[model samples]
Target: MKIKLFFLLFVSIFSNAQVVINEIDPDTPSTDVKEFIELHSNIPNFSLNGYVVVLFNAGSTSPYSGTASYYAIDLDGYTTDANGNFLIGNSQVSPTPALDLPETTLQNGPDAIALYLANGSDFPIGTLATSTNLVHAIAYSNTSTTQPTALMNALNLTVCINENATSNAANHSIQRKADGTFEVKVPTPGMNNDGSGIVFNYLTTTFNNTSYTEGQNVIITFTTSSNVTSPVTFTISLNNGNFNASDYSGNTIITIPAGTNTASTTITLVDDSLDEGDEEFILYISGLPVEVVASNNSILRRVEDNDYQISNFGTPLAPTYGNVTPTIPTGYYASLEGLSGSALKQAIQDIIANPAVVHLHSYADIWDIIRTADQNPANHSKVWCMYIEQPMSKIDQQQGSSIVGKWNREHIFCQSRGGFQVALGDTADGISIWNTTSAANVVDGISDAHHIRVENGQENSSRNNKNYGTVNSSTVYAGPTGTQGSWKGDVARSLFYMAVRFNGLNVVNGDPSEYNGSVPSGNIGDLATLLAWNAQDPRDDFEMNRNNYIYTWQQNRNPFIDYPLLANYVFGPQYGQPWFASLANSILNTDEIKIFPNPASEYIFISGIETPTRILIYTLSGQKVLQQELSTDGKISLNLPAGIYFVNMKSEEKTETKKIIVK
Candidate 1:
C-alpha cells in the first residue's frame, strides 16, 4: 500500500528540474469556480521556456483518445519560484501569483495529463513524436465512477504516473506523496510534500451560501462528530479567483476551544462598481486537533453580481399610467442611434447582446417580474395582462398556481416553437430558464423576459404557436379579441425579438430542440406579416408598459416599439411587402386634386382630373376594403361605412394617398 522509494528518488532527482503536474483540484462546490492543475520544479530558477502542459480527457478512442479535445499551455515565459514551484490553472482563476490555463483543460476525473518539450515538431495526441521529449505524465480518477481506461492506454509509456484514489466532491485535491504514491492530502501547493496536516475523517465543513451578493458576509462552519478533549486551532487559507484578498475582511485562521464541537468564521466581501459575472474564492483548512479527520477540507464561495440592475426611472405600479414613457439607461441605446433600416436593426441586436442587458433569474422568480414589474400605477392590487387589458390578481404568480379563471404566465412566443429550456427539463444539456430546484416551467428560456406575459389560461392555450394572419374555422385559435387588437403591434414586436435574440449557431449541434436550430437558419417568423402589423397597430400605452416592464427585468428594449419608423427601414414594404401590394410603383401628383365635404358620412365628390383614376381604400390594419375606377370630373356617391380609412388614387401620370374620415 506504500509507494516505492526507488521510484520516488527517480522522480525527485531526475524530473524535479522538469515541470511536473503536482496538484489537481476538480469537483469544486460551485458550478462557476475553476478547476486547476499545479506544477512544481525542484530546480530553482527553472525557466519553463519551450515546455507545454497538455490534458488528455477520459473515455476516448485511438486518435480521439489522444487527439480529441486537448488543452495545452506553453511554459515559455514562466519560471519556477525559489522553492521550485509553478502553477498553471484554468482561466476561471485570476493568475497573479501563477500561470494561467484554459478552463477546458481539466475534467472532474478519469483524465490524463502530459508535459512535453517543444522541438519545432508536431506533438498532437496519438503522435509518437509526443513521447520524444516527454518530461512527465499522470492519470487520476474517482474510484466510485468508471476508471479512465482509454486515457491510460493512450499515454506514452515513456513517462506516466497513475493515482489510485477516489475523486472528492468537496473540492479536495489528490496529491503525490514523497513515496512516489498518490493520495488525497491537504493541498500545500508550492511547498514540499511532507504530509503534515489535519485529517478530517470525523468532522464536516459546510458553507451557508453557494451564491451571494457582493458585500454580503460568507459564513462557514466546522463541526465535529463528538466533543474534543482539548483546544484545537486550524490554519485557514483563502484563494481568490477573480477577486482579491483586500475585498474581504477576515483572518486566515480560526480556533475551536476545548469541549466545543463547532467553530465558525465570517468573511465579508466588498462591493465593487464594475459590471461583471460571478466571481469566486476558496476556503481551505489545515492543522486539525487530536484524533480528528476531515470529512471535507475546502469550500467554494460564488459572489453573484448586481451592478447592472440599473433603474428605468419609471414607477413599478401596475394598472400603470398608460401614457408614461419608458426610460432606457443613459448611454445604453447610444450604440443604436443614427443607424437605420437593416443596419439599425443589427446595431440594436448587438446592444441587446451585451451581458449587462441580461438578468439571470430562477424561473420560479419570474412571477415577480410579471407581477411586480408590470403592476398598475393606479392600483397596487392587480397586474395587467397583454391579452385582455384586465388586471390579474397578484396571488396567481407561482408554479402550477392560478387564480381559477384568472391569469398565468404565458409564453407569447410559444415554448415549443423556440425550444427554450425551462425548469422541467435536463438543464445540463443547455440553458434553462427555471431554477434547478423549483417547479417552474422550463419551456421558457431563463432570464428571457420579453417573450412572456400575463394572460388568461384559456386565451394562452387558444393562441399557442398559431402564426398571425387572417383566422378562420380551421384555425385552432384566434388571438384575444377584446383589447388584443390594440396589442397586435406589441405581440408582433415580441415575436420579432425572439427571432433576433435566438437566431445564431446552435450551441448544441444537431439539436433542433433548442431555440437556435429549431427553425431554419436565419428565420424566426413571417417577416412581411410582422412588418404590416407594426405599421398598422402602432405603439399604445399597453405596449409601452410591456416594453418598460420587461426592460426593468431583462435590461433590454424593443426598438420597434420605441421607434416604429425603424420597421420600414428594416423590413419595409419593398423588402418584406405583404402580398396585398401586387401593383408597381407610380408617380404621386397632389396638384389639382380636390374633394368636397372631406369628412362627409355618405359620399364625397372628386373633380379636376384629366384621366381615369383608380381609387383604393384601406383600413388602418392594412386591410383593403374598396377598389373602384373613376372617370374624369367624376362625382361619386355611395353607401360609406364609419371609421378611419386611407384612399389611394392612381393614374398613368400620378398617384396620391390621403386620409378620408367617414364619420
Candidate 2:
C-alpha cells in the first residue's frame, strides 16, 4: 500500500515534466535484434513512475483502438540515472544498468512512439487519450510518406522526422543531439549523445555477365577498403524478374567482420522448361557504417535459357525430288506401321505430342535450326526463301538485318489468326528476319512459335495474317506478292502440321473466318484455295528438303509432303478410307517417263515409251480429261487448255505417271 501511494505521489510530481524520447533504434545490425529507445530528462534523478510508451504502426490515428496500438511498454518503477538518461529496449548484449523493455517491438520506422502518464491504471493502451496525461511523442520514418501521423496535434508534437533520408536502418540509430537536432549516428543506449558515426572507407559490387543460364549458381561479391570501424552488412532480394519464387534462393543479409571489408553470396537459380527469355532481377545493398558511401546502390542480374542445346541440331537430307533412299530416318514411324488415313493421323498426333518429342527450345535455337534447314547447300552461307525463290540473301547469325540483306522467319499460318501461344512443351513461337523480330519480342512468359519460314521482311510483313492466294485477287496479300510463284502446298501442309501438333481453343479449334473442326486442320486459310494450290504448285525439291530438315529436329513428318495423295486420304475427297500407299516408289520410278511441252499452252507430247500404249491426261483435281490409244512412241494429247495435268501411260507390264503444267 505504501509503495502504491509513493508511485502515485512520484507520478504527480514529475508527470508534467516528462522525459523526452531522445533516440530510437528500429532495425539493428543483426536482423531484428538490438532495437532500443532512449529517454532524457533536463531534471536530474527524475522518476518515471506511472509513465508508459505506446508504439503504433504506420497509418494509425489519434482515437486509438485495440488494433491501433501495436505494443505498449509499461514503465512503472523506472527512473533516469544521475546523468538524466533512461533507456528501454533490448540488444543481443544488454547495456549495463539499463531498463530492458524486451516486450517493446520497435519496427524499422515510419512508426509513432507515444509517452503517456497512466494515472495508476493498466494504461488504456487500446483506448483514446488527451493531452492532459500525455508527456511526449516522436514519429519518425525512413520513408517520409510512411510516417504515422496519429495523435500528433492532440499530443502537441512539434515535428515528425523523416529519418530514412538521413541514415541507413541497418546498423545506425536516430540520434537527438544536445542542441535538439536529429541525425543518424552510431547507437548510444543509456549514454549521452556524441557526434561520432559509423563509416565504410570503400565499397564496390559487380557481376561478371548480365545474363546467366537458369539452374546455375550465380556469385556476386562486394569489396571494401580495410579501414572499416564497424562491420559492414547489407541485404538483398530478387526485387523484380519474370521468374517464379521457386526458381531461385540465396542469402539475404551479407556481413563482413569488423576487421575485414569484403564478402560474397551465391544465388542458385532453378531451371524449368518455360520459354521465357532473358529475365532480370536486382541485387541491393544497405547498412553501411555512417561514413561509408556505396559505389553503386544495386546491380541487375539476367538469366538465360539453358534447357536445350539448340546450336548443335542435325542437318536436313539433301534435295531429292521423290526418292526414298533416305528412308524417313529408321524408326520414324515404327509405331504407326499398320494404320492408314484418319486413324494414322490421330496416331501421328499423339506421337508428336509426346513430352519427349516436343522439346522446349529458345527462339535463338529455332532460328539456328532454320538457318541450317533453309540453307542452299550449293552455297552454305545463303538461304532460299520458301515462297520467293530468287530473292536470296546471305545468312547472318543475327536476325533482322535489312530486308534485302537478311531473311526473316515467316509464319505461313499467322500466329494471331488463332490465339496459340508458345512455351516449354507447346509450339507457337520464330527464324530469319522474322526470327530476329521474334527474338526481340521474346518475353518472360508462354508464347506460341510463329510457325516460321525464311523470307524477307517485306514479304513477311506484307503476308501478315493474309491467306495464301494469287496476290491481286486474294482478300489480303500474303505469300509471293507478284508472279514469284506460290508455296500453297507448303503453307497448307505447315498449317496442317500446326493444327495436328497444337489442339486448343486458340489453335486448331479457333478459326475465325472458317471453322472445319477437324484434326490435322485444313481450315487455316481459304481451304478451297489451299487445296487448289496444293494441286497447282505440287511439292518441289526445296519443299521436300525443308520437310526432311523440319522432321530431323522436330521429329515429325509432314504427311502431305510424304504422300500428296495423303491430303486426299486425310482431308481430301477420300476422307475416311483405310487404303494407304507410299508415293515414294512411284516418285522413284518416274525418271523413265518424259512429257514435252511442259507448261504447255496448246498440247503436250509424251515420248520414250517401250511401245504404243494407252494414253491418259488427268488434271491435278483427279479429273481424267483425255483417254486415247497412243499411235507412235507414246504420242498423244492434242487438246487440254491450261492447268497441271498428270499423264498416265499404261503398257503391258506396269503404268507410269508424269506431271505436266499447262500455261
Candidate 3:
C-alpha cells in the first residue's frame, strides 16, 4: 500500500500544522497580535541583511509550550528561530549554536535586513528600515520589556519632508538607528521677516581690506543673518589670493529670495594690488544646502599713517539721515538792498576826499569798498554805512568800481534842481557862500561870498599893535549889512549862527559862516563843528603871512625855474639808498636782532629786540660804528670787537646787523 499512503499523508499534514499552532493566541489583543504580524511578514521589504526575529511567547498559551524567546534582533547576519523567525534562505539557521551572525548577515539572508516593526508604547518605538541588518525585536508580554506589540502592524515608514521644515505638515518624522543611522526630524521654520531669528547663519564673502590702499573704495558691509531661510546669493572676490570656491568659482551669482525676511547686501572691494598685508578674499555663496563657507581676512591694514586717524567709519547706528548748519559770511549783512544812491553818494565822496579820510565817516564808505576789494587793506574802514539806501541794483560790481565812476555828478540830489546842486569852476566862484533865500532855499542859497575876514583895518592894527591880534583874519568881512540874508532856520542852526556871528574868525580860513552852503545844507554842519573849526585856525594869519611873502618871492624870482624839477621826479624803487641797503640785508638775514655772549669778554647780551632800533658796533675791518639806543627790555649791552665784530641796528623803519665775537 504505498507505505500506507505516506502514513496517511503525514497524519493529514500533522493536523494542519497543529491547526496553525492553535491560531497563535499568546493572550492576543495586541491588535490581534498586530493583525497576526501583518499576515506573516513582508513589511515593505525590510532589510538589514537578516534577522527580524521578534517572537515572545513566554508563559505560553500552548503555542508549542511557550518560552521561545529572541525579541528585537536584526544586526543582519541571521540567527534567531526559537520562534522569532529569520531563516529566509538559509543564513545557517542557528537556533543557539552560540550566535554567529554577520557574514554580511549570513550572505544576505533577509537581504541584509533593516526592519523597524515596533509598538512598545509609541513615541518612537520603531519603524525604520534600510540597512545591513539589525532589528532584534520582541514583546508578546514575555513580561513585556517592549517592542513586539506585534511589531506595530509590521512596519511601513518613510516621512521626512523639510525644505526648511515646519509650517504644519504634521511634524514630519523619520529615524533609524540600532547602528544604521538616518534621523530626519524636521521642524525649524520660524524667524525670517527681519526680526532676525533662525540663528546659525554666517556670511563674509570676499570683503577684502587687505590693509586697503590701492584706490581703496571699500564699503564692505556684509553682516548677514536677517534670518535667512533662503535667498543667499553673494559672490565677491578681491586680492584674489585663493580664499576658496575656486577663487569665486563661477564668478557672480546672488539670488536670496525665499522667505528672506530682512536681508542685507553690500560688497564693494577695490584693491587693485599692493595692499601689503594679510589679504584674502572670496565670498562665494550658493543657496546653502549646508556645507557653508565664508572667509575674509583681508585684514584691512593700509590706512598707512592712518589716513588722518579715523574720525568715524562705522558703528554709530541711529541716524538714518539728517543734518544741516552752515551759513556764515559774517552772518550775511541783510543783503544790502541793491545799493546805489549814486553808488552810495559816490561811496560817500570817496571816503570824504581821502586826505587819509580823517576820523572816517559815511560809515567809512562801504568799509573802504570792502577793505580795498578784499585784499584786506587793514580792515578799519569804519564799519560801512551809507545811511541805509543802497539800491544801485545791489552794487558790488567789484564794489561798484569803488564808488561808481567817481560820482560827484555835481553832487547829485537834483529833482530838476529843486534841492541840492553844484557845478562851479571859475576857482569855484569862491565857493558860493549861501544865502540866496529861495529856490527851495538850500541854506539860504548861493554866493553870499565872504570866505574869511576880520579887517576893521586889521582889527585896528592888531588891537593897536598888541600883536596877539591874529585870532584869524585875512580881511574879507563885508557882511553885517552888505545884505545877503534869508539864511533861515536850521541849516545847521543857521550855520551855527553864522559861526557865532563871525567873532574873531576861523573856518578853514574862509568863513562865510563856514559855508556848508551846498549839498542839502552839506550834511548840516556840526561835524563836531567842522572838527572844531579845523582844529583852530588851520590857516589865515593873513593867508599865512601872505603865503609867506609869495613863497619868498617865488623862490627868489625863479631859481632854476622855481623848484619842482628833480628831473620831473617819479622815482620809486622804494626811492632811496638801495632801499636802505635792501632793507638792511633783510634785517641781517632775519636774525631779527639777537646778540648774546658771542665771544664777548665784558658784555654782549642784546636779545631779540624787534624795534627800539639804533645799535651799532662794527670792527671786522670795516670800522666807523658805535651807536646805541634800544630798550624796552629787548636787552642790550656790548663793548668792543677784539676779534670779529659788526652790530649795526638802526630803526626808524629798519636796519639790522650782527656778527659778534669780542673775547
Candidate 4:
C-alpha cells in the first residue's frame, strides 16, 4: 500500500515546480539534439513574467576538476511558436540587457548551466513548456575564437497547486450515538469554506429513524460545511436500508437553518437487523453554500462464542505376534520344480508372517504363489504384503510401454489369473505392488503400499513372462542368459527396493550400474514395522509373538489369553516401558542438547540437535504437536501450555526422544 501526504495551507507566494532533463552527450554536441523541462505552480492563471537561469557544470576529474557557470534567458515577453518552441535571446558574452549572471570562480573546464525561472508565478499556458511541451538546450565547446560545441538536452517540468480554501473553515466533527445512530447539525453545508476546495460531498437520504435491536446495530457518520446562508436545500437518498446520498431531487441540498447561518441535521436508524459481512452506505450532500460530499460505510459480523472438544478413537489392541518364534507351513511351494516346496514355503511364510519381516526377497513365481495363498479365506486379512519390482527393458517392450509394464509387474501372479487366482483365494482387493520407475516412484509407491493386502496367484509362468526372445535382441534366451546370476540379481534388487520403500531405511550402498553383489543387513525389523505382545515381553514381532504364545498355550495348558486386562495393559502407554525416553536421552547427551524454560509455562525451546535432525513433540496422551527438521542452530520451540510432553528427535546416526514438563 502506498500513501501520499499533501499540505492544504501555505503562506508563501513562491510557485512549486519540478523539472527533468534527458538526452545529453558528454563527448560531443549535435544540432538536432532535443531537451525538455516542466514547471508546476499553484498560481491559478500564470503567464511568463520573468527570466530563467541556466547553469552548466563540467564532469569531474582526478583531484578537483569541474566548474559551474550560469546563463539567464528573458522569458517574460516570450511567445510560443507553432511547435511550442521559443528562442528567448541570441547567445552573447557574460551578461545580457535583461539578464545577469552571479559572480563565481571557474574550477577547470566548461560546465553545464542549471536553469531557474524567475517570477514563475504568472507563467502563461503555451508559453512555458510542460511534460508534453519540452525545452531543448543546444551548446557546443569553443576550441577557437569561433563557435562552441552545441550541447543538446531536453527538460520536463510539472506544476502542482494547493487550491484548498477550507483550511480556515469551521471545524466539523461527528460522534456516533449510543443508540447506533447519528446526530448531525441540520443543513450540514455550513461547516466549511463554501465547500469549493472539498473533493467529495455527502448528505443524508431517507432517515430510517428506527430503533436498534440487541445484537444488530453498527452505524457510521460524517460532517461537512458551507460559508454562505442562501438556505442550502439538501436531500438524502436511502439505499439497501441504509443512507446513500442526499439531494434536492437526486442530490442532498444543505439549506441554511432558519435563524442561524449554520445548519445541522441528525441521521438516525430505525432498522439494524442487517447480516454480517460488508455493508456500504453513501452520504451525498449538494447545493450547499458550496459544492461538497462525504461518504461512510461499515462491515458487521457475529462474534463466535463456543469451546473446542476432542474426539477419542479408544485404545489400540495388543499385538498378536510374540517372541522370535518361527512358524513355517508344510508343502507351501510344493508345485515348484527343484525347489524344497515345504522349506521354501516355510521360509517365505516366515518372511511374510514374522513381525520382524522388515524385508523379503523372491522371484516373480514366489511372489505369485504367496499372493494366491494370502487370498485364501483362512489367510485373508491375516497377511498384509507388498511387492517391489525392478524396471526392465524386456518387460517394458512386452507391455508396450514402461507404465503398462509397471502395472503388469505390480499385479503379477495376481488373483485374477483363473485357477491360480481362485485356488490361492486371490481377489482384486488383496494385492499391492510397488514398481521402481523413477525416483518419485518410490514416494508414490510407499504411499500406496502403506495400507494394502496380499493375494497369491498359482500360475507363475503368466506372472514371470518368459517370452523375452521377441521383445529385445539382447535377450535372445528366455528370461535372461544366465541361469541363476540374473535371477539372483533381480531378486536382490527387488528386495532392496522393498526394504527402502517400506521402512524408509537405506541399507545397501553400491552402484546399480556396476551390478556389485553385496549382502544387505539381515536385521528384519531394522526397517520393519514393530509389533509387541504380552505387554511385558520386550519383543516387537507380531508373527513371533503369536507363534510363541500358541506354542506355550499348547504345551503348558495355560489359559493366559485374557490375563488381567490384557487388552488395555498390553496397548497402553506403559506398554513399551519408556522406549521414547531412552531414545531422547541418547540424542540429547550426544548432540550438546539445550532446552529453555525447563519448567515452561507455555512453550519449550530446543537447540543443538545437529543438522538434518527430525524432531517430534508429543503429549503424554500420545498426541503429536511438532514434527520437522532442526536446521541452522537446531532450535525447535514446542508449544504446549502448562503440561508434560514427550519429544522424539531422530537422525541418520541415532534416534532419541524424551519427556519435559511445561510449568
Candidate 5:
C-alpha cells in the first residue's frame, strides 16, 4: 500500500516533467544478446514507480496484435542512477541492466519502444499498449515505408527514423541526443551520447549490360553499404526511349528487401515483329531514397538492345485478310519484269528483302503464323501437319508447353543447315525463331514465314538438320511424320525461295555436311530430288492459299508458289529460259493442265499448256465427232448437247483426256 501511494506521488511529480525513453538496441552483432532499452530523467535518483516500457512489432511481417505486446516492463520499484539514467538489458551488457532479459528479446525495427506513466496500474505480460498514460516514444526503421500509420500517428510520430543508417549500420542503438531527436549511434546505455562509429552513407544501384534484345529480360539490382530497415520499393525511370513505364515491368516497380545488400528484377521487354534494328535505352531509379545519401541514390545506365519473350510480354500475331487474291502489292514484282535465272532470283530477293523498311517478325510469333498458314481445309480450326498430312488443332498440345502432341514451327530450310540467324529458342515456351522465316529476320533468312511450316515436335526432332531430299527412297522415314511428297514439294519450294532470297545459301545436287555454326553459309539439299518432287507434286491449292495468305502479313510471296514455272526457268529442264508471268498459267503449270469452268454453257478457258493445239470432242463410246484448232484466246466453245462428253486436248508435247458436261 505504501509503494502504491509513492507511485502516485512519483507520477504526479514527473508526469509533466516526463521521463524520456533515451535509447534502445533492437539489433546486435549477435542474436540481439546485448539488446536493451534505457530511460532518463532530469532529476538524479528519480523513482520510476508507475512507469512502464512497452515494445511493439507493428513493422514486422506478422505484427503483434492488441493484447499481444512483444515485451513489457513495469518500473514500480526502479530508480535512475546518480546521472539520472536507467538501463534494462541482456546479462552480457557492459554495465549490467538493472533488469535482466533473455537473448533475442528484440525484433529488427519498423517497431516502437514506448514509455508510459501507468497511473499505478502496472502493465504485466500479455497486456496491450495504451495511449492514456503515454509519456515518450521512438519509432524507427531502415526501409522507405512501414505499416499502419495509425500506430505512429497515435503517438504523434509522422516519421520513422532509421536505426540501421550508414552511421549506425546494424548492431547499434538509436539514441536521443540533447535536442531530443533520435539517431542511430554507438551503444551509450546509462551514459551520454559521444557520436562515435557514424560512417559514410551509401545505397546504390548496380547495373549490367544496358543494351538488351527486344525480348530479353535483363536483370537490374540495387546495393546498399548498410543493411536496410525493411523491403524498399523503387521504379525504373525511362529517361530516353521509345517506351513508357508499361514497357518496364508490366507495372514498372522493383524491390530491394532488408537483411540483404542487393535485390533484382528483370526489365520486361517487348519482343515485337517490326524488324527494327538496334535500339538504345537509359535506366535509373526513381523513388523515396531509403536511408541513402542523395549522391549514392542516383543511377544512370546506358544499355544496348543487342538482343525474348519474357514474362508479361506476349508474342504478337499477324492480322487477318479476307478471301482475296492477295495479288502482289502494287509494283511489288515490277523489278522482275524480263529477268530470269540468277538475275531474276536476285531481283526477287531484293524486292522481298526491303531492308529500308525492315521486314521481319518476332521469333515468338511462329505459333500464330503457322497455325493460320497451315490451316486445315477440312477443319479451318486446325493446322495441316507438314510431314504427316493430318490436321492438328491450333489449341492442342504445343512443344513449349511440354504437351506431347499437335504442332510447332519447322524450318523447311533447316535453320542450322541453311545458316539462318534466329534468336535463341525456349522450346518450353512455344517459341522458336530457328525456322520461323520471319521477314524481320530477312537478312539472315531464319524468320521467313514462307519457310516455316506446321510440323509436329517429333518430326521436328527427327528431321533435325537433315537435308530436305529423300533419305532412302523417300523422306518417309519409319515414322508417321516424314518428308512425304505432298510436303516435299512444299519444302522444296520453300528452300528454293530461301536460296533465291538469301545470297551465299545454295541448293546443290548432293548431300552436304550439316552446318551447325553461328555464320550463315553452305548448301542445303539434294537439288535433283527437290526438283523431282517439285515436278511430281507441283503447287496445289494449299500452297497457293498460304502463299496468298502469308503475303497479307509478311508482305512478300514465295515465287515458287506463285509462278510454278520459275522452277523450270531457274533450276529445272528449262533452266535459263527467259520467263514471264503468262507462263504461270502456261506450260510452267501445264505438267498437270487444269480446265477452268468445266460443265460450262458458253466456253472453257485453259492454262498450263502452250497455245495452238488440236481440240477434239469424242463420245464415251470412243467415236470422235469433231476437231478444231486451239485458238489464241485459249478458250474452246462448247456447243454440244447437254451430256457428258470426252474432250481430247492435243498439244505437240502430249495429249490429255478431259470429261466435260455441256449444260
Candidate 6:
C-alpha cells in the first residue's frame, strides 16, 4: 500500500480515456524484440487522441528530481480494439502491436514509463519528466538494487523490483497486481494481470454425427471444464445461404446450470417438400456472458432429403441436353452411310433439296405454322417467339396495328438474301422452289418454313437484316431462362439447313461487303461465327422437338438436329472423318415410360408407354439376347444369369433404356 503513491498522484479521477499501463516486458532472452507495453481502457473502444507515452532515462548526470525523456510516442487518432486494449511492442511481438518499436528499442535499466494526456510536442526526446497532466506512470528495473533515477520524485513513481534475483529478467515481466502493486511474474502482454484471456477457457462443443434427415432432430452438446455456480448460456446462429427461420424449430440458446458442466439443445428441421435435394448449414456460437467466447466458432452440418427423386428424359448428355430419336423412317440416312467430308455434305444436300418433300403454306399462312410448331411446352396456349426469345399468346398475331404482344414471321435467311417467293417480295411465305431442286439457282424468289420462325414484331425490325455473328451490336436475350445460349445453337442449325436446302444463296465467312444481296444473287455471311456456334452449343430438346414437328409438315427433317456432330463432319474441323449413325446419340425421349422391379429373375412390368413397339434385351457387351413385340399391358418376361443388362423399350415415337441387374 505504501508503494502505490505514483498512481494516486497522477491518475485523473474524471478523465475520458481511463487508460492504464497494464503490463510491461522490458527484457527477453536474447534481443529486445519481444519487449512490449500493454495499455487497457475501462471504456471499450475508447479514443486515445490527446495521449502520449514517454520513456524517461535515469542516465542524466545531474542530481535533479526530473529525468530526461529518451523516446515519446504520440497516441493521436488511435482507438483501442474491441477488447479495450492498445498494445505496443517490438516487431516480433504479437498480436500485431499498435505502435511497432525497433529491436532493442526499450532500455533495460532504472527507466521509467509514463502515460500522459497531453500534446506529443510537450515531450521532446531529451525533455525532463513532469507530473503535469500525467495519467499513469511506472518505474521498472532489471536489477534489484537499481541506480537512483529522478522518476521516484518527478513522477512520484517508486522503482519496482525486477526478477533478476529469482526468476531472472529474461523470463519474467513486472505486471500490475489486483492490489495495485507490481510483481515479477510470467510475461502476459495482452491478457489480464491474473492471466485470463478467455472467460470459459475450457468450453467445447461436440456432435456424435454430422448427417441428418428432414423431420429428424439434432442435439448438440456443450461441455465446460468445471461446474458453474450459476447458469451459463450461449447462443447458436445459422449461416446457410437459404436458412429460413421457419425451416427450423429450436430455442437457439443453450444453457448449463450449477453443479453440472454439460448441457445440450435440440434442433428440429422442417421439410421443404424435398424440392431442395440436400441442405447444409454452419452453426456459429455467440452471445455468451461478458468477456466469454466460444472456443470453436463454427460447426458444419448436412441433411439428406428423403423425397428427392428425378425422372430423366432421353439419353441425358451429362450436364445439359439429351438425345431424342428424330422422327424419320428407319432407312432415312441409309444412302449416306460410310461417307465423309464434303461428299457427306453433298449427299445431305441432295436428300433435302427436293422441294416436293417439304410442305409449306404461303408466307400469309406462316401464323398457322408458328402457332402449331412454336407452342410452349409448359403452356400450350402460348407460342415461343424468337429474336427476343419470349413466350407470347397464340392469339397475339401481328394484325393491322395492335403490335404489343404481336409476333411476325422472322425469315432467318432474309428476304433479300434468297428468301422471297417473288422478285419484288410478296408476303406469300416465299417463291417456292416447288419442283425445282436446291441446285437450281433462283436469284430472288425462295422461302421455306424451315427458314421462317416466330419473332416479336418489334424485335424483328430491331434486328433488320444484320448477319448473325460476333457483332458488337447484338441483342442479348434473357427471357424463358437459358434462351440466350440455346437460341444461338437454334439460329446456327437453321442457317446451316438453309445453306444446304437453298444452295444459290451462299453463306460465307469473308468480308461483310460481299453479302449485301438485295437480289438474293450474292452471299449472306459471317458463316465462320455460325459454324463455331454449332460446335460450341449442342442441340437441345427444344430444337429436337421443333425439328420433329417440322418433319410432320414437310416430310423432311433437319439432319443436323438428329446428329449434333454432323455439322462438324460437313462444315467444321472434322471435315474428312467417316460419319456413322452410331455417332449420333439420337435415341430416346420417353419421359413417361417406366420399368419397375428392375432387377428381376423372370419378368418385369412396364407402364406409361404410348404405343407398344417392341422390347429388346442386351448384355453390357452389346450382344442382343431377346426381341419381341411389347404386349398391351406393358409386360416383358426375362430370365438371365446374374449380371448387369440393359432393357431397351422401343415405342412408336421414342425408346427407353434402363440398366437392370438379373437376380
Highest lDDT, which number?
A: 6
Overall local distance difference test of candidate 4: 0.29
Tens digit of lDDT per residue, candidate 2, span 1-663?
999999998677664564888888776534454677888887656877778887756543333222255567777777776557677765332342255544225765556677877743444545443466667777676665553545455456667676556545566778887677788767776567873333225467766666677888888877775646667777766666456566788886888777777888888887887645446676656666544545444355666555432322222222334442233765665565556665877766666555554443444556667765676544444565665664353423334233433477776666555443454453324322221112112231122232567776666766666655433644544455464454556676666555555553122211244333533222354443455455555566666666667665555556666656555434443344453354323431345556786667766666666565677666555567888887455446466676556665666534555556677
1-663 per-residue lDDT for model 5 (tens digits): 999999999777765564898888877753456788888887777888878888766644544223235677778888976567788887556454667665667666666777887733455544555576688877776554553354576666766777667654765778888888877767887565653332323555555664455666767666667777777777766545555454445445767676766676667666655423334455545674524422232233332232211111111111122323546667666777778777877777776665553245655565667766777655454567777667665555364333246478788777766666556652324232222332334345556788888877767778777776545634323224332446766777887888777666788766676653656445777766676566556566677778877776666788887765576556654445566675555332234466668667877776656566777776543456668786443777766667555555656544454556578
RMSD of each: 17.4, 18.7, 43.2, 30.0, 25.6, 24.7
Per-residue accuracy of model 6 over 1-663 as CA lDDT, tens digit each: 655776664454335446888888877855556888888887666788889998888873444235889888899998775666777887556444667665566777677888998988998888988899999988876666674466768887665556464545567887887667778877766567785444433456777676787888878888776776778887887557766676688888888887788988888888767455456667777766643434344455776655644323221122235544557788888878899976887888777766555554444555666676666554455567765656665556787433444687787767765645633443444323223334454432244566678888877776566677654544322223344555666677787777776666666653244233454444565655666566455676667777877776566778877775576556554457688776565444445566678668788887765565678776654467888786555667886788756666656534445556689
User: Mind giving the per-residue lDDT tens digits that candidate 4 earns over 213-280?
Assistant: 22332332334333332344555443534333221122223465543434444433233333222223
Model 3 CA deviation exceeding 4 Å by range: 1-197, 200-231, 235-588, 595-604, 607-663
Give me the candidate number with maximum TM-score. Answer: 5
Point out the higher-scoring one by TM-score: 1 or 5: 5
Ranking by lDDT: 6, 5, 2, 1, 4, 3
Please give the lDDT score at residue 64 for candidate 4: 20
Task: Report every candidate's CA lDDT.
Answer: 0.57, 0.58, 0.27, 0.29, 0.63, 0.66
How far out, in Å, is residue 423 in model 6? Answer: 9.0
Q: 253-308 in candidate 3: lDDT tens per residue?
A: 45556565333344333333332322334232333433222322222222321112
Q: Estimate each model's TM-score.
A: 0.38, 0.38, 0.17, 0.21, 0.39, 0.37
lDDT of 1 by residue, 542-596 (tens): 5676677777656667766665544443444222332111132233444467766
Q: Which structure is stronger by lDDT: 4 or 6?
A: 6
